[model samples]
Target: MFQLVSTIVIRRLLVAIPTLLLLSLVVFVVLRLLPVDPLAMMLPPSATAADSAALRQQMGMDKPIPVQFLIWLWDAARGSLGNSINFRQPVVGLMVTALPATIELAVVGLVLALMISIPGGVIAYVLYKRKRETAADLVVTLLQSIPSFLWSLLLILVFGVLWPVVPFSGRVGQEVTLPGITGFAMIDLLVTGQFQAWLSALSHLFLPALALALSFAPLVIRVLRSGLIDAANEPYVEVARLRGLSETRILWRHMLKNAALPTITMIGVQFGFLFGGALLVEMIFGFPGLGNLMVQAVRGNDLPLIQGISLIFCVLMLAITVVVDVLYALLNPKLRNL
Candidate 1:
């Protein structure tokens, strides 16, 4: 099993290298092709043509496209991603600081999404078998039809503006400052025994996390429901039903377990969507995550920052895919042979 896992990891890494390289090239080309000039970001509006040319030359933007790409790639290989033209900080430093926040948000949001989606989907399927066209089904359909960002806006208006149940934007209250251990607010707060800070952090996290969860929950539910329905009709489930097993026992032990494989796979696949949604969600709530940093980089035409972030995202996706594949293999032993 260890050998198998190692072989899988090696093979996946081999594929991931080229995939990331292609992604790097695409990001590099797209940023260069954008009409916005990075020089405009660096210089004053009154700066003359000569000044612009000189600045471009000094920054090595005057190099040929292929030459520029080769130099950037070489620097990247050496763990030097250059500096953020806008923030004037090391691109790697910016990513390191921002990555944890984004990861924390995404993990929390996924937890929230799974917490609701799994049970909701399972119960819905169980109930639907007894009665078709139930209210739960309709609710799922309605939620799926509405755009996530629109729901985010509505949530902000209702919860943030009207009732004021939770903090509207940002990670924590301005007055509350906890140690940045692990750069995860909840973790840091708990580790320091700062319950008040923890509560405040939860309050700030609730809305954005809820919004992100609601956005992805419908898809998760749909996938789970379909998988549950199919699994319930399998031969093993039929055998269990005939062997004097209770309906609940058969459903939970046999059907749900088998059904869960697909749902888990779907969760991994939907990670990209979750990450993409985080970009808008972070911007709307003023959360200082990688997505927000990415948005700022784009507006400033920060090539190194953009390339770094994009490459990071591509690497993350590839790593996730490998984990999901391994999980699928473990859950369904038939896949182990492959």
Candidate 2:
């Protein structure tokens, strides 16, 4: 079992290298293809022709396109990812600081999703089979269809403006001093004994997290429902029932276990999407994260930052898919020897 798992993990890591390289290439090419010149975009409005030319030369924009790519690629290989002309910080440094916050937010959001989605789907299936649909199904369906941004907007209005229960526009409440631990303010503060900052950060994160889960919940429910329905009809389920297993036990233990594979896949996919989607939520709530950072980079036409971040996202997606694949193999016996 250990060998099997190790083999799978190493294969995934090997596959990830090329996937990341391809991602870097696509991002580099696409950004270079953009009409705006990064050097010109970064210059002041009052700059003269000489200033523009000097800025272009300083940014290596004057180099041949192929030559410029080598420079950027070399920096990326060295873990610098170049400096952001807009932020005036090393791209890698900025991401190293912001990435953890985004990952934490994604984790929090996915946790909320699973907490609500799994049981919601199971309960809904149980109720649906009995021909007595509950209000939970209706509510869950409704919540899932609404856009994430709309929910974020509503959260800002309710929690930030009207109720004042949470501060909407920053990493922490203004009064609380943040200690930069792991770059995830909520976790860092809690670990460092800054309970006030921790609570403040958590308070602000709640509505957005809830909104994200709600937005993605329906699809998870749908996937699980289909999996459950299929599992219930399997010959194994019938055999279990014939053995005098309780229907409730069969439903929860037997059928649901078999049904979880697809649910896990969908959940993983949503999480990959969440890495990009959460930026809007982060921006609306004034959270400093990769998504917010990407938005800033895009607006400033900071090509290096944009390319680096885009590659990160592509790599993130590849990693999630690999995780889901391994999980699927683990949960399904047919996948083991294959």
Candidate 3:
């Protein structure tokens, strides 16, 4: 088992390195091909020609595109993620400040989505069990198909505008306040043992999390429900039942274990979706996160920062997918044994 796990890990690492290289190279070239210049965007129109040229030189605009990318890539390798043109802060430091909020948002949203999806899938599978004529199934399908951004907007309209139950967007309550922890506002507050600060953060994060949950939940429900339905009807399940296993035991302990693999695979893809979806939601609600940062960087054509962020995102995605693939192998014996 150890050897197998090690081999898989090594394979994933090998794959990951090349993937990162190619992804970063593509992203770097694409950013350069754009018409905008970093200096033009950073400085106001009233700036003198000399000032712009000087700023360009300072930003390494004088260097060839290939030369600039190679330099930046080297710096990135050395753990220097470069400073942001717009924010005037080290990219690493900024992520340290911003990542916590984003992590919290993604974590909470994922948790909620799992909660909604797993149970929903079971309910949907059981209710529809070979009888595909239920309003509930239709509702889940329709809801899942709808885009996450649209749901967030609708959430803002309903909860933010009409009901006022949940705040529209943002990671913390304006009135509650917090000392910047650099990376994680919520954790910083908790680490400092400030319950009130945690409360403020919670209120701010709740709606966005819900929006994410609503978006991801349907897929979970659909996949898990189908898996459960199939597992429940399998010959092994029947044999287990005949062997005097309790129905609940057979369904949960045995069936759920097998069915979980598909759900886990879905989660891997959904994790990627969470990052992608966060961009739109962050923009919609003014949430200060890496997604929001990326948007600002892109608009200014901040290549260094954009490259840095994109590279991080690519690594994150690769890591998540690798983990998921390994998990898929581990959970299914037929896969791991090979």
Candidate 4:
């Protein structure tokens, strides 16, 4: 097992090197090719020629595009991604400050997705099992077909505009003031014993998380339900039944265990969607996160910030891929043995 894990880790790292290189090259080329210059955008239009020269030199933009990318790549390797043009802070510092919010949102969204998916999947499978074409199944199918952003709009319309049950946008209420502990508002509030602030933050979080959950749950439900149906028809399930195992035990312990692999794979794949979905959702609802930061950076032509965020996102996706591979091996021990 240890040897297999080591091999997988090494192989994944090897694969990630080329993937990151290609990503960096693409992002650098694309950003440089844009008509706007970061320095020009940052400086006033009335600035003289010497000022422009000095700014370009300072930003290393006076160099050839290839050389500039090389320098940026070198700096990135050293964990210094330069500074953000818009925020006037180190790219690393900006990412550190903003990443916690995005992470918190994504984690909450994933939890909500799982909570909705697991039960819905079992119920769907049961309906399919009994051959009952119910309204619940129709609802699930409709939800599966709709895009996440549409759900965001629907959530905003229903919960924000009409009923006003949850806060429309933002990560916390203005009235709830608390010191930043871990950068996550809810955690910071809870650690400081500010229950009201925590509740406020949670309420603010619900709408976006719900949007993400609604978007992801249908996929899980479909995948898990198919797995369950297939696993149920296997001869081992009948053998387990003949061996006096309860139906519930056979379903959950035996069937669900085997059925979980595809769902787990789907969850791994959906991590990217969660982050990508959060980008639009954050933009829609005015949530201050990495997504918001990226939008601002793009508008301001902040190359450093854009490159740093893109690189970080690419690394994160690669990391998720590695994690999924490991989980796949662990769950299907046959691969590990091989």
Q: Residue 102 of model 4: what lDDT?
A: 85
**Per-model tally of clashing residue pairs:** 0, 0, 4, 0
RMSD of candidate 3 to true structure, Å: 2.3
Q: Write the per-residue lDDT of candidate 4 for residues 1-338, one digit (tens) a residue.
A: 87787888999999999999999999999999998868876679799999999998988898998999899889988989999898889999999888888888888999999999998888888788465747767888899887778898999999899988889778889897757778998888888888988999999999888888898899899899999999999999999999999988898889988899988998998889899988888888888889989999998999999999999899888888888888888998679679
Question: In candidate 3, how many clashes are counted?
Answer: 4
Full-model lDDT, candidate 4: 0.88
Query: Pairs clashing in candidate 1?
Result: none
Model 4 segments more than 4 A misplaced = 129-131, 134-137, 336-338
- Residue runs of model 3 more than 4 Å from their true location after superposition: 44-50, 129-132, 177-182, 333-338
As a TM-score, model 4 comes out at 0.93
User: Which residue pairs in candidate 2 have backbone atoms (N, alpha carbon, C) closer than 3 angstroms, thus clashing?
Assistant: none
**lDDT against true structure, model 1:** 0.86
Give the clash total for candidate 4: 0
lDDT of 2 at 313: 84
Q: Across residues 1-338, which tens digit of lDDT does each residue of candidate 1 receive?
A: 66667777889999998998888888888888888787688888799999999999988899987788889899999998889999989999999888888888888889999898988888788776576647788889888776656767888999989988889788889989859778888898999999998999889888888888898999898888899889877898889888999988988788887888988888898898888888888899998899999999988878889889998999889988999877877788676666
Best by lDDT: 4
Best by TM-score: 1
What is the per-residue lDDT of model 3 for residues 174-290, given as tens digits with 9 covering 90 to 100? 676666665577777898898987887877788888888898998888888778877887899999988999987787788888899988988998798988898888888899988
Would you estimate the TM-scores of all the predictions? 0.94, 0.91, 0.91, 0.93
Local accuracy of candidate 2 as per-residue lDDT tens digits, 95-213: 88888878877888888988887887888788774646767667777787688789888877887788877667766677987777677777788899988768888876777777677
Q: What C-alpha lDDT does candidate 2 achieve relative to the native structure?
A: 0.81
